[model samples]
Target: MRDILVTLLVFGGLPYVLKRPMYGGLMWVWISVMNPHTQGWGFATNFPFAYIIAVTTLVSLVKSREKNSFPLSPISLTLIVFVLWMNLTTPFAMFPNAAWNQYTKVMKIMLMTFVLMMVVHKREDIHKLIWVLVISLGFYGVKGGIFTIRSGGNDRVWGPVGTFIGDNNALALALIMTIPLMYYLMHDLRRRWMRHAMLAAMALSGLAALGSYSRGGLLAIIAMLLFMWSKSRHKMAGAAMLVLLVPLALLFMPDQWGARMDTIGEYQADQSAMGRINAWYMGFNMARDRFLGGGFATYEPLAFALYAPNPAAVHAAHSIYFQVLTEHGFGGLAIYLLLGLLTWRSAAIIVRRARGHAELDWAARLAAMIQASLIGFGVGGAFLSLLYWDVPYYLMAAVIATRAQVSLHLGPERRYARPKPLGRPHLDAAQTGPAKPEV
Candidate 1:
């Protein structure tokens, strides 16, 4: 009974459907409670949801006959190889136990994230993700918003969107991540109400992020806006809405707008910047000297030995780029950059082809939003080790993979010309004729 059910859900269930909200919630709980690496299940780590979804996704593909070509992208391949290389070569010592622990954790879950995108190829699956996340955000937003107002607008009182952090920064970051999804639904949707709801969600998320009072979270929002504007002028509507709405927010803001704005720049001029700068400097020096990176995730101990004058105080580079340079080195860095370029180009191709075509409009919108999200996360990623969440990179991966699928007539609509049959050279399979081509 167990094997039969597993087989059925693995191959049959996921390709056609995203499990409904209750089911998804239940599964997440089960995974959190059952998974071992999630040794800290109730502790606000992303392991529960990100790792669970990733594992189920991989298990779904285990015996399936789906094409592995989807997973063969240059970036994904490089990441796999580089991950192996880093562990084998880099001397990670700050938290050796924690580092190796996270090492296996990231490789396992992140690769699974790649596979999840390959399986979830349908438009509705994306839609389901949007609505589901919207509900989650909305529920938490109201809770935090109410708590903020009640507590005289103190950020400390609000839970980080019901996360383990209990600080609102995590919530702010989560909301920042969800912006692309909201934009995807809003830009691509044909229905009037759905667009309005997405707009509302956008507003709530913006306010929620603002309420967090985290300098990093606010910069992330700004980065998201920059990416959104770069995509197209439609983003101006979102900007306008927020601009108009902020005055009202200021009325009840509790803290002066001037103080709030100043806080963004004055995040304490201590080691936060100094530490990151030191890490970055040593990382590049290491990269320049070795050119192949010290190995994957290998910057801290090496930096301590060479630059810090004390081996005890070294740390991971706050910047992912610097981390790549420090750990994976130039060769790994080159491969990483090339993968990004390829994905961006793939998304561009889809957007260009879908322009002004109604049937393909959603595909184009999705592609643009996914591309935007990747760039947004890339910006946020500079300041933190942010590989735990699966959405940003997975969506980017999906857009690239879907471009290939769409190019081969696998997306929502079958608008492309059907391939000619070899046996009866000109006959259309659905119609017994000499293939009367449509103009």
Candidate 2:
């Protein structure tokens, strides 16, 4: 049944995807993020759904004369440069075979991301893309949250097998990032039941993060909540939700979970934390010497034996900064950091400029939520080697798409002008102050 359903969905959706191209982009995101075929033991498990979807989308996009061209932003440019650097570093990798294999996977992710930028050109397309992400990953979040609640938070939450976020820690990070997107959807989804359902999903997703019992996940959630509340138009309401949700989640988790989190304060004594620190040092030393760095798989035991302070404790570059620092040179790491900075700035610009424009209020809300997601990823990623994870880049694409839509709706006269920093006068008399953030 599972195989048949997945087959039907893919084959049935292909014609529509070929027609719209944008739909193909959404389908690609859904399959890549959700790994729906991995959910059950069926024929669909071996099907090449992503490849088929990508090809169909590419062919359709090339044949069609869609008015929605890719937005030329700093974010997209930096991403292209980053990909080139990634390829350049692979040949110099400590293990060329392993590095090349990893490079191929990373390339696939980047290709689809660019495809997304080209096809997802309208505000409606952006909204549907968000919906695809929310539903794809939220399935795990809602399920994991319920399992945590039922099991008293004794068992760990995990993502699908053979996927990027398969571990307990990774799953927590994905869920944390997803909660904001879910909230964004709730604002525009007119049905009362759908909005309420999204609200529940957000709560459960938070609980599921706690259930993961990851120290980094805990810290990431803290940072996410702080920013979500601070950026919200109505501080009291956002604060109230956090105040209510946090306590309930705490009460739901078992004593063991709290003890695990308590280890954050005693990292010097925790072996895992100590090992990560050692790897971080190795990454720094490798980047300091090797112009192109050691490339992917640089964390080999032999390399650690040569550079690490504690030579015996070789570990993976758990930090994204270190992951890039080791895999690509400092120059590459610099570009990666700049990519994040520009993406953040772009989102901020949207949130500030859209303000209270009734039609574009949805864009403002999305910008805020994407900002919150970045906060979660930034904090969580410091301890997780997820440099190539699709979520962050996908969010970047969404930001660019949303901003373009806002500019289009504003018309030529108001378009192309730099958005004033927040708190200044609105761009035009039509623009109002920030709207009260949706509850």
Candidate 3:
């Protein structure tokens, strides 16, 4: 029954998707991120819904009269280079078959990311994209949160099976990153009940992250919350909420969860932690030996034997930085890092220029929230190998689309203009008796 419902929804949505390619992009995002079809024990589990949607979206995109040009910017350009670099390294991968398989998967993600940027141009488009992302991921977050509460955090929360976030740790990080996007939506909403709903979702999502019992996720949430607090306009209110909520959430976790988190400080005693270190070393050593590195699946026993300090400690590169370095070499790491840096800078630029403009405030706020999400990804990603995850890339696309909108509204002359000053201007000193000091 679940499979039938999912199939009906996907097929039913196709006509609308064809009429409006952006709808296809949003539907594709929902399918990819939520993995709704995977919820059932049936044929829909292995269906190529994403592929069908992608092809349809592409065909519609070509035929549509909308402004479909890709937003070219430093971030997008760097992403293209990164993709090219990935392709360059694939031929030399230590394991060609596995490399090619992973390569195909990553290429598809990037293709859709680019498509999203092309189709999402207006402010309304960006809002719709955010709504899709929040709803899709927030489903897991809200469900996991409830499970965490019901189970009393005794059991870990997990994601959809056979997906990138299938693991408890990965799902936790994804939820942590999602909290800020939920907040972004909450801020934009005018209805009190809707805002309250988003607030509830954010709270539950945070709990869901804690319930996953991922130490990396805990640290990531901390970093994200701190950054979010700093970025928020209502600092005092934000501070009070953090002070009240964080401890209560932490206290609610079981002793076992606390013990697991404590292992972060005692890594030498944890096999998993040690294994990750060994994998990082292996990646670094491989990149040093081969300029192009060993490509995907290079974290195998053979490479570990050659490069890892403890050759017996063969493990996946648990860190995104190491994963890219090991697979695509030093150059690839550079370009990858460049993409992140450019994305961050672009968001900052949007915030700075869009401030004081009521019309562009949403873009400014969205950019700020994206930065907070990036904080979670950057910090948590250091301990997880989700280098090609769709969320971060989609966030990058959001930033690009947002900056483009800001530029369109501000025009070329004011695109890089400083934020307009707030408050009424004071009279000139010469005209106002040398400006009387405030009482």
- Which parts of model 1 are misplaced by more than 4 Å? 1-59, 65-71, 74-98, 129-146, 149-152, 156-171, 187-196, 229-239, 246-268, 289-305, 309-316, 409-439
Question: Clash number for every model?
Answer: 5, 0, 0
**Over 4 Å off in model 3, which ranges?**
413-439
lDDT of 1 by residue, 331-432 (tens): 766665765676777788788877777777777877777676666567666766443444445555566555655665534434578876678465456767
In angstroms, the error of model 1 at 301 is 7.4
Model 3, 45-85: lDDT tens digits are: 99999999999999999999887998878898999999999
Model 3 C-alpha lDDT versus the unseen true structure: 0.92
Kindly provide the TM-score of model 2 when superposed on the true structure, using C-alpha atoms.
0.92
How accurate locally is residue 129 in candidate 2, as Cα lDDT from 0 to 100?
A: 89
Residue 413 of model 1, lDDT score: 37
Q: In angstroms, give how far residue 2 of model 2 lies from its true place.
A: 1.6
Error of 2 at 123 (Å): 0.6
TM-scores of the candidates are 0.69, 0.92, 0.94
Ranking the candidates on TM-score from highest down gives: 3, 2, 1
Report the C-alpha lDDT of model 2 over 114-202, residue by residue, as the tens digit: 98998887787888889999999899999999999899899999889989899889999999999989988888878999899999999
